[model samples]
Target: MADETRATALRVGASEIRADAQAKAEGREAYAADCYPQGLLWAGAVRPGARHGLAHARIRSIDTRMATAMPGVVKVLTARDVPGTNRQGIVHKDMPVLADQKLRYAGDPVALVIAESPEALRAALCRVEVELEPLPAVCDPVAALATNAPRLHEERADNLLGAAEIRRGDGAEALASCDVVVAGEYSTPVQAHGFIETENGVACYAPDGTLTLTLSTQAPFRDRLEIAHALGLPFERIRVIAPCLGGGFGGKDGATVQCLLALAALNSGGRPVKMHWDREENLLAGYRRHACRIEYRLGARHDGTLQALHCRLVYDTGAYAHLGAEVMALGMEHAGGALSHPQCSDRRSVRLHQ
Candidate 1:
């Protein structure tokens, strides 16, 4: 093959043509949010309205009677409708797909409303009243570990989810011996993936007792396992198809609408169901990157050679334990020698303050 006549060499300095760029630029791209099939019912989640006031609270009651009676509303579902564990998470299945007994955060889903029309879905969502009993929110990570702070999980003694760390080569002693030592703590806020596509998916319940899910997701295969586990359905019965994402940005890696949409499809009586999160809903219900506080003490030779590194990290997982501990482990391991991240560490309080 001649070098100049080759296909790869035909376009060196010329403008390149892309398959999707033109359509996307001309606003002709078909996104998951734009997926509207015939006779599909609309599903919208009813979130805790109480979070506007408190960082944490207990659900006294979720009043869905008004929503049930609304025109064009098909069904109203709660956690009780979910089967099996009713929990969703890749690494830790601690977060409930729907808040059954209590509302952890203000954005926790308390109700799922299916409607014949989008307008009906909106109206039903507004009518689903949620009464919350306020609790002392563990807003402070350090204070959350206090002897008397409210426990987020009944099984957990304190508010600490868990921790991951690594240590090697007497780094603490090495830091002291180093000619130059720098000790500082840096904190990072909870960052959103902020993808243009806000967790949207379409699901259909087949008459043959199978569920088909089509959506914009980064993890379709994992979503099948999550859906089946949470809904108590046979894993083989759920079919997942991931269309090209409008935007995922890692936010779609976890369960956002997968379980909820499947549940809606189950109750819809073989009808096609669509659940598209609006900007406001996405902002409230979407996944957030861990808000981490990192305390690092770096010691190095005066001649600028890397020597010792000591770091402590605390991450706020918000209401649910997402990939919090794993994220910490990744950062910690990147800086030190191999050490297993701690799981179920027995209580022995360490306080730096007198």
Candidate 2:
């Protein structure tokens, strides 16, 4: 039996070892961040500084003269430079590639600076000056739902991104009649993916206008569509090559560096353009797990059998709607908890501006 088990373990298809594990352990596995093509340019985003304080604001103007005049600085592009709809998302076609009229969040990129070197790119970005008109901001998800609250998106009449309710039986009536009832409120903070790789990608535009990108992204196929839609390029002309990622706990499952790298490549005069987000930028601009507040009311019989459950889930989905609706729907689906109950009432809402 022992000999047979060893033989099975040695079989090609039945091997217990991961094929890439050895390479990765020996530092021989090449990730997207390791790629450095010849004649590569560096691109960086200029976001609202800490001095701005407020996340919500109007962009009065972006003065790129200083950065444009700096040595090795290639070009400073803003939202106007983006060709297509300038929007990218999975299901919701929101989130601007660059902030145009409004700076939706403190980390919102207002300008893209391209340079011959990473040092030049950072220096140039620092030289770019922006004038903003501060807008009334909402920090609380519940407060953002108030009618008197300032609107984050003019299109969205309210800060509510999505809402839904699930009902199985007469939960309200059942709760009142139960022999024992308990209530509680639970809250969770916004969580970062904290992937070791961070967000980085390299893109090069061919003479024929074909754009190719090699990135550490979890969604390479979807990235092609996102790049095409955001930059007005033909979907067929875009190619995304996803390499072995160092880490990506759902953080790279969305846009991340896809659209930005493509846009930088387009303006790099056909040279390969590389954009890498450092740890700080990753925390500020990365897609994060939603912060949630949940209220629960549980009713049980004298025998300790659960009779009814009522739950209200509210999630702060941040400035942009990145799978906000789907996130809320998932929470609603699981509001009943692990134990089964005959009656359950679940209400969920996804809010923005957090």
Candidate 3:
């Protein structure tokens, strides 16, 4: 028995076996996506521009009458149905839980539906029609920076979400003194998280008014405050439970279904509410890594000694500021190469556009 116990004990520099490996390999381990509580209602959001290609538009009206009349649908909620501020974000509270006025992106939620069944949820969501007045949309980062470009957020003056500059020493002067200089322009496209599990969660509002959520998320603790602020619930009354995630890759670092699920629970008549973003919906609404354009200029002496580095980075943060400034800051920090440089200057801009 002692020998068997020793075999399972952890040791330094030893290959520690994962306890859940066997269950996962056998498809027996239950993930958050696998959670379906009894008496749970299905919740889904209606994105006005998802199928119509209207990236930028003014929401004229949201028709939820037909959806509300559905047989199994419990409730159809719009921005007015939201309790509190209805806004949520990490650094900037610019994103609305449900778009009340304007549709900045095709993925912005216009209406939320709660149903007794998945079929009812789908049928009800389809019935929730939205009339939008299309507006000009800027896709490219450079074009978005133009003075005349359309602004996604009216509160902001320009399409630039955030900007920062890092200077170590005399960057341009040192580059001019170098014997060799190389310049290049590089661009990367928007990439999705594509997590196998997608974004899924379940929430319940207890009789004591505690909102408990079980989700497959990377930032469970942060989700608590996001839900609280969006739904007007007290932070102490909210509970977030993070189960084993199939994959996150930084995409689940923000609220996905946290606010929506809580909203559903609030109107679910004390029953639990579940929300699962399908493959298409996940691709449509999931947070993406910023697509960026980099203008890099490197200076080196004739003997190959690195002298100075200067780079300008412009990031496309889509229609919302979801950690856009922080992401740009990280890009600027890594602009310098592995070696130390006497002079380095990095400028970064986060653009808000489709």
User: What global local distance difference test value does model 3 have?
Assistant: 0.88
Residue-level lDDT of model 3, residues 68-164, one tens digit each, is 9989999999999999999999978888999999988889999999999999998998999899999998778899988999888887788877777
Prediction 2 global C-alpha lDDT: 0.87
Each model's total of backbone clashes: 0, 0, 0
TM-score (all chains, Cα) for each model: 0.88, 0.95, 0.95
By the lDDT metric, which is better: model 1 or model 2? 2
Residue 331 of model 2 has an lDDT of: 80
Q: Write the per-residue lDDT of candidate 2 for residues 1-354, one digit (tens) a residue.
A: 999988888888774878899999999999988999999899999988444786899999999999999999999999999999999999887899998888777888989999999999989988999999999888889888899998888987788887777877788898889899999999999899888888999999999989999999988999998888889999999999988988988888899888988999999999999999999999889999989988888988899988888888889988888888888888887778774765544344444545
Query: What is the Cα-based TM-score of model 1?
Result: 0.88
- Runs of candidate 1 with Cα error greater than 4 angstroms are 1-19, 26-28, 49-52, 336-354
Between which residue pairs do clashes occur in model 2?
none
In candidate 3, stretches whose alpha carbon ends up further than 4 angstroms from where it belongs are: 1-13, 344-354
Error of 2 at 271 (Å): 0.4
* Whole-model Cα lDDT of every candidate shown, in order: 0.78, 0.87, 0.88
Tens-place lDDT digits, model 1, residues 296-336: 67766789765776777666777677776666666555544
